[model samples]
Target: MSRDCTDYRDIFLNDRPMMDARAPIEFAHGAFPGVVNLPLMNDREREQVGTCYKQHGQQAAIALGERLVSAEVREQRIQGWVEFARAHPDGYLYCFRGGLRSQIVQQWIKEEGGIDYPRVGGGYKAMRTFLLETIDHAVAECDMVLLGGMTGTGKTELLVQLSNGLDLEGHANHRGSSFGKRATGQPTNIDFENRLAVDVLKKRVGGIQQFVLEDESRVVGSCALPLPLYRGMQVAPMVWLEDSLEQRVERILQDYVINLHAEFVAVHGEQGFALYAERLIASLNNIQRRLGGERHQRMFLQMEEALVEQARSGSVEQFRDWISVLLREYYDPMYAFQREKKGGRIEFAGERGAVLEYLRERVNQRV
Candidate 1:
């Protein structure tokens, strides 16, 4: 039945659904996109089996696992696998190493359901290695351009416009700033790397050898950039994006205040506005050390006032005051310092239109 598939590239490139048979803890620690964990053994069972193996060796441990699972428990798990296999006929199942655990599941599925379901030949570890190699290879071989700008300059917006753009913030589910967190939390670091690697692989597969990426530090909110891409970004030619302070402030108002408030509302419903207000306050507090005591207190008071006005009148106009001050007095200077440091790598500098045109030309030039 050709039940072991080893085509890692095809599986990822096609966004194939996958069933992960590792313990729940393992799946939570690291997993690819579109993967569901239907573990062969739950955490407790796996732990017991492991302890038994250490004490009594493999055969005894296997016997203990079988007894722990019993017939009824085994049938329940097999039924879940049967349902998943039927639901995703094209999907493959895997364990940490495609070892005894995955083999046992395959044999059970066939014996109980008379169905031949495939498993990933080398499983999760092998697939992770492949993704890491993908990122490393792209870093070494691809031509990449970085979009640099002050806060609120809409660097992310520009990146999305390019067909070859790699939106790291988008992949990380963050805004890449002190205020970048979304209503939902960021993915695990392993999940973040897996997603980033998959994105680069699919883009490269689509003939995008040249990529446009936002200039960012190693860490974006909670997700860190893969080391290879971070190193590449340090020396990559940069297109600096510029905007008037008034315009930048307005953009930040939209992204951090207006849009973010709505996002919180959508996610949390009745509790949304309160959570939104809390998030804003927390975001402000995050930079307190840098903002200094007096300035931070002032900014904090202004933010509290703005949130009151927003909650009362449903108007976000008040946010512009704090947003503008932070950008001018805080984010602007920091970004400016970074710009000066990376001055030699700056190939072009202009407002959005000019920068977009310049970046597009860079991609076309490669073509």
Candidate 2:
């Protein structure tokens, strides 16, 4: 075999494990799912090499890089590559452009470790381009639906139950609302886009000619939707989810207050509640201008008192007061306006089970 794989669709569809040979900063900015960064050069070393290349030429930079990663450092890096190669025999490795850096790694792995591990042809740049194209292609070719609902009508909950459902919020690691932030920070925009592209590609490859996505703003948290997909969503058919106000309140309580606090506790351990309280207060404060001073202060007081009560007595009952008010006064009206605007596109409107059944049937109709 040539051992230089360029089949981007198959690579992503199979969820192939990948070793990213880019610098740490490069990987941090964006990388595919199931990829592990095992950089041939750290950020400092890569910077030094880039400077040398610009000042002295390619030969001089190559000499400098060899000098920088000699002996002990070279052996250590090779050892990691060997371990990864042994573990994922079918996996591939790549640098930013499948050029000198990856070739060097491949050569070293063979010379030192007696393994002929394959490298991804054209590397990260090419794979990323393929994924971007995947999203655009799906936007052009596939039948898409947008699931919309008032706050806490369980749109996301119903979305996950379908084979063709595309959970945009899950991919963005955000809930797509003011209180949507999680304990951990979101991925970089590039990372989020890459993840979403891979998902669309894999689903399409699995024979899904249609996809059901949440009706989202152009931006989800800090991650912006691909322009093609966003534009498609603008004209796509919509399914409006509905629920009783009492049920919506309970769902919000579980997802935003109880579950979100537990998530913070899990991530931050001893300081979880403190950080969770700060996040909640900050989230509310973010909307202070819109909520107006009087309403904001009233809700803020309710939130603060609720937080205090929860801290002291583990009583979350008080949180319902603020959550219900915010839903009724803030979220409901805004979403009602959205529903009216999207009324022409609303193909079906129903409660959770009904909406889920309709979406499933829509997906089936496309088959």
Question: Local error of candidate 2 at 112, Å?
Answer: 0.6
Q: What is the TM-score of each candidate against the true structure?
A: 0.98, 0.98
Which regions of candidate 1 fall more than 4 Å away from where they truly are?
none
Candidate 2, which ten residues in sequence have the lowest lDDT sum? 358-367
lDDT of 1 by residue, 83-121 (tens): 898898899999999888998888888888877999999
lDDT of 2 at 228: 91
lDDT of each: 0.91, 0.92
TM-score of 1: 0.98
TM-score of 2: 0.98
Residue-wise lDDT of candidate 2 within 54-91, one digit each (tens)? Answer: 99999999999999987998889999998998899889
